[model samples]
Target chain A: MIVADKKPIEEIIESVKEFKKILILGCNECVTVCEAGGKKEVGILASALRMFFLNQGKDVKIDEQTLERQCDHEYLEEIRDVVDQYEAILSLACGVGVQFTAEKYHSTPILPGVNTCFLGATEQRGLWTERCQACGSCILAFTGGICPVSRCAKRLLNGPCGGSSKGKCEISKDVDCAWQLIIDRLKALGKLDEYEKVQPIKNWSTDRAGGPRRVVREDVAL
Target chain B: MLAEMEPPKGVDISVMMENASRVKGEIDAFVVPEMSNAVMRMSALGGALLLQKNGMDTVMQVCCRDRNRLALQADLLAAGASGVKHIMVVTGEDPGFGDHHQAKAVYDLTLLELLDAIEKMENGHDMSGIDLCGSPQFLVGSTVNAGLSAQALESELSEMNQKIKSGVDFFITPPLFDIASIKPFLSCVDLSKTPIIPTVLLLKSLGMARYMARNVKHVHIPDELVRRIQNAPDKARECVNIAAETVHAIKEHGFSGVCISTIGWEDKVPDILKNIS
Candidate 1:
């Protein structure tokens, strides 16, 4: 899932300081699962903002609403009737959702409430680690199910670069050696022979290095 | 003849070679290590140029972790033009391993990809099919792990064979505490003509030895050696003696010359060389 972290209250206050009336919009999808910009978080942020304004002797009107999914147009239409009532919206969604909401709303200032992190999986409730870079070209099949581009510090297609000590990356003890894991997994699977096959230089056009990507299928397209 | 050494502080060659002169005749070429911990110093190629200016042959170590193919190829051609004859290609340590934790690593090309590009350049063309006015020449080398688990040896060798097939002129192994530790790796790979230079690191203290054994990947320090260093009366002297002894053992095993990673203990290299010779 696309992970995001809640913005600090101080930063959020600074962003909306100029506006007295604002809508705190939340997403029920990735931000919800990550607990950043979901319904519960939106409620907490609204209360916090209200308390801040009350303490400052300022009256700020804040409205809270959580969309099923901020990225889709269907869920976004529900906010059109009320969006004009507020000066701005503090979106508690990933970057994609914020942009989508802004595109549809057109004039309302769409403010981000959370920092979008990466495409990752939750190791536990509080801990999330990156798993994929969405590099477009996936080589997990050759790497024993591990993603080198996301996991390897150098993103080396052929590596365990000389700095790996034990099974850890040279950058830190906390990071695992992606190549080491690949070799170990291949060894366990009795496919160690595959480890030596050097992959060609990557054509990064399929990755973010190329540009914003788009996928179109004629069969599904009208 | 390549003496594996760090770049001098501020890249002051005079101060750097002051200690290097102690082993003048012993080392014909010097190999400079790339920056560790993201702490800036003289670049590997820059250090090699300094050494070459001093009348010593040098091998500039290049890593794929930081530079893209364009930068790498540019550096290689620059080194060749400067008369540097050898290159040691390495997949550099992750930047997180260094002090600069936030630096983004640009592993644009893998070790194989870099090596392949070097081979292509040697054959008179750039990676993008741009023909060079003059093809640069280099004796390309790479590093390998000496200590591998029995189960992982085949996989490691496959990587080694790939390096060999990519036109690596020689393979330099990580530091070896015991010759026996590398025998399993050696027996599996055919190194009939290729020279396998075993690295010998000077273990300064029990802590250093233990840290390497427990933390460094693919490096195995024997328990006996660790105990010996732990119990030694004078660790400094014992470390030198052990290094000299290992160099002798490596030579006796019919391996190519030793690459001693002195790690600031270069002052004692002459003694180690004298003792071994």
Candidate 2:
């Protein structure tokens, strides 16, 4: 899932301060799961903004709404009638959702209230860890399912560099050495031989090095 | 025959130059390390160039920790053009180990990929397959961890073989206190084709020895040796004797050569090599 973190309340206040009427928009997708942007968060933000403006003795109208998924056009159209009522939308969604909302409603200003972090999983209730880089090419079969591109400090294909000590990365004791994990997993599965085979120089063109990318699926196109 | 020399942390190279001149006739070449342990310093290329200008042969170490492929290739070209013939490629220590904890590590190319890029440049093409007007050739050397455990030794040997296949001319092992400790590595690699130069690191004190033994990954400092340093009345002299003895033992074991790393005690390098000849 796309993980995100809420922006500081001060920054959110400053961004929406210029507008007299504001809409606090939230996404019910990945942002909701990560606890960054959701229906509950939208209500909390709206109440806070109302109190902030009330304390300043200003007449500001604050409204809250959360779509099923902000990226989808059908769910976004549900707010078409009310979107023009507000001068700006403080979107508590991923960057993708904010941009999609802006594209759908050309006149309204869409401001991101959360920082989209990475494609990751919730390690526990309130903790998230990155798992993939969306590098277009995957090599998990050889590496025992651990993603070096996302995990390793160096992203070394042939690794466990000399800095790996006591199964921890040289960067931090908190971060586990990705190569150590790969080696341990391979050893457990009796597939240590896979590590012996040299992984060739990566063709990075398939990665972000290739620049902004797009996928055109003729079969799935409407 | 190679003695490791660290570049000065700041601009002044007078001390470094003086140390190199002290051991100029005694050692074959000075291996200028590139920010080993991730501590920032003047680049190895700059120090190597200074020594090269002073008519001393140098093995300038290059690591994939700091530079991207373009910068690496550019520096390699600079090294080649400036008459540096030996290049030791290492995947350097991570940035967190050094002073700059927040600096982003740029391992844009892996060890294998960087080696392949060097090979490509030698063949008159860059990594992008663009033709080069002049190709730079180097005697490439890389480090191999001489792991003690059976699993680790197997993995090291496999990586060593891959390094050899990648056109590494020779190999250098991490510091070894006991000669018998490298028996596993010795049995695996045929040192005839690609000579392995074992490092003889100067153990400054018992504390350093204990620290390295406990914290360092591949380095193995024996308990007996640490006790010897602990027992010695003059511990400094004892440390020098231990380093010199390791070099002598390396020669007796029939390894091609030895790399003496003084680890900031550069003045003691002459002392370490004095009895070897």
Candidate 3:
């Protein structure tokens, strides 16, 4: 999921101090699961900001709307009719949602209420740790479902470099070595030998290096 | 600069330390706990937790809708052990308003009954009437929201006063978005001895203010601050700075202290606290 943290309220207040008619766009994807940007989050933020604005003696108008998925164009197109009417948009989505809102609403300014962190899954309440780099590929199969791209400081395909010791990353002792995780997983799957078998370097062209990527499945084509 | 924040100047520190030194003096912040966790979501829970963890000396909020009396009692015990210091009682919002639409709700105890039970527990009896090996000493608090309906508000306050008589140490309020929101209710404050900590909702975004204006019944968002948020170059930060500024205003208005309630935008609380101190 697209992990994010709500932009500090003070920072959010600073971003939209100029606009009266505002729309806070919430996303239902990663931000929602991570408890950063969601329908409820948008509602709460709207209420709190309204109270703050009222206290400051400023007249503020806010419209709260949550999208099924802000990163998708179809979800963003839903608010097309009214997007022009608002002075600005407060996107409670990740960076992708903010950009999507910005792209869709060229005439209106779209602001971010959340700081887009990397892709992650929720470990539990109030804890979200990064998991994938989304480098336009999935190498989880070879690494036992753990993405070395995000977990390892160096995205080594077959790792446990000399720097990794005692299953701890050399950089931060507090963090477990991603390579060690890979080894544990591979061991569990009886593929510990696979790590020893060095794989060839990946093709950078298929990743973000080549620019925007699109998926077209002929079976599902429009 | 990682924001060099020391305990303000000597005079300020002295006054602040003096205030801090009164920890045992029986004064409580009495901020409203978000009773409707599933209805309001964990952001509300997260917000309250952050405040208590960050040193607001906050109260733990527990409502009856999400859990049965067992869950409520367990969480109550958890909050007590977590150093939350206080607990607020509420018969939470209905589950129909929540995402778990089809989920069943268990309301084993009403707000007043919950208070009585807590009081009994505080006096060292378990809710089951059995002697517990250990029990926590908690300052039990309750909420006081001026209902959108006038008569309901009056009856609620009277009922709340009754709760206070049954060992509610203090009372916290629903968001006081505007002065008018609190004024009419303050004129009717019937409780004596127990301090009332009026809550000020910190609106951190212009869009948020307008959302409350339309959706939240009883809460009114003023036009002026919205206009300022509309005019500021950075609206989100402006929304929050204005909120921090509001905390100052609320403190200045002679309320006990501001109950920092912005959950999603809690980073602003430190800023608000910085300015308030």
Q: What is the C-alpha RMSD of each candidate to the true structure, in Å?
A: 23.9, 24.0, 21.0
lDDT, candidate 1, B154-229, per-residue tens: 7877888899899898888888888887778878766557688888888888888889989988787889988888
Mark the regions of model 3 whose C-alpha exceeds 4 Å error after superposition.
A1-222, B1-58, B147-149, B190-192
Query: Which residue pairs of candidate 2 clash?
Result: none
Best by lDDT: 2
Tell me what fraction of the real C-alpha contacts between chains A and B each candidate also makes.
0.00, 0.00, 0.00
Q: State the local distance difference test value for candidate 2.
A: 0.90
lDDT, candidate 3, B65-160, per-residue tens: 667677766666666676767666777765556544444456678877777777777777777898755676787767777534577777877787
Model 1 alpha-carbon miss at residue A215, Å = 28
Candidate 2: tens digits of C-alpha lDDT, residues B202-275: 99988998899899876777888989999999999999999999999898888889999988999999899886
Model 2 chain B poorest 10 in a row by lDDT: B95-104
Q: After superposition, how far is residue A156 of candidate 3 from its true place, in Å?
A: 48
- Work out how many backbone clashes candidate 1 has: 8
Cand. 3 Cα-lDDT:
0.70
DockQ-based class of model 1:
incorrect
Query: Chain B, model 3, TM-score against the native?
Result: 0.74
How would you encode candidate 1's per-residue C-alpha lDDT over A61-116 as one tens digit per residue? Answer: 99999999999989999998999999999999999999999999989999999999
Off by over 4 Å in 1: A1-222
